[model samples]
Target: MPPDSDSPLPTDAELQILRVLWSRGPSTVRDVLEALDGDQGYTTVLKHLQIMFDKGLATRDESGRAHVYAPATGEADTQRRLVEDLRDRAFGGSPETLVMRAISSEDVTEEELSKIRALLEEADGEKDDASSA
Candidate 1:
């Protein structure tokens, strides 16, 4: 399903589950538990899965003894929505402001800078093509 523009982002617990589902596809509660931090309990994992299902963030297949839960939203869509939300809330909805924050905030190593420069170059190329067209 498409990420709801105004829909709230997943809670940290939900995000943790989603990262697993996103990377591994539909997963059982057991699978999620194994992948998650050892500090969390088995019941805690099941409880979070149930809550996520109720919240429309997940779907379960009950054909098997152990149900498999999958994310309803695409990972990219969710990430975009979240980054956009942060951009709006923390950076006044400006990509430049968001980039500035990322650049100025903690230790941005040369590797990160190189990647950012490449992305900027690609964006510039896209803009030039659009304008020229």
Candidate 2:
């Protein structure tokens, strides 16, 4: 199921579990716990999955003996939501400021910079096309 737009964002622990689910596809609580290297206990991971299901961050398949869980939203969708939330709360809703801060804070690779430049050019092209229309 797709996540509800109104659903609360995943907490840090929940995000970790979601990443595992995203990478491994649907899995049981044991599977998730093992994938996490048992950093968190079985019950802890199970509880997180239960809460995630309630929050629309995950879906559970209870048809089988061990309930299999999967992420409710795609990775890209989750990332976009996270970035948008950060932009609104920390950057005064300015994506440029967010991007600038992120680039300055990290040692971005040259290839990454080239990708960013290409995206910017594509955005500019779209803007010009819109204006021409």
Candidate 3:
């Protein structure tokens, strides 16, 4: 399903589960648990799955003994929501501020910087194309 822009951002724990589902597709509770490798027990994972289902962040298939879970939204869509939320709340809706703050950290790798540059160039090209059209 297309992501609902109105949906609230996923909590940290919820993001963890979403990440697994995004990467691995539909999975059982056992699958998520093994992927997490955290101290959280099976019951905790089950509870989170239930909460996610209720929140519409995930869909469940219960045709068999084990219910299969999958993300209701695409990874890119969710990431966009998360970034937009943060930009509005923390950067006064300034994309430049967000990007500057993000790159200010020394932990950002050279490869990451290259990717950012490439994305910026691509966006610029798109703008130029649009302006001339």
lDDT of 2 by residue, 14-87 (tens): 99999999999999999999999969999999999999998889999999999999998899999999988999
**Candidate 1, poorest ten consecutive residues by summed lDDT:** 1-10
User: lDDT scores for all predictions?
Assistant: 0.87, 0.92, 0.92
lDDT string, candidate 3, 80-110, tens digits: 9999999999999999999999998999999
Pairs in steric clash, model 3:
none
Write model 1 residue lDDT over 104-124, tens digit each, in one string.
Answer: 867999899999999999999
Give the worst 10-residue stretch by lDDT in candidate 2. 1-10
Model 2, global lDDT: 0.92
TM-score of 3: 0.93
What does each candidate score in C-alpha RMSD?
1.7, 1.4, 1.4
Task: Give every collision pair in model 2.
Answer: none
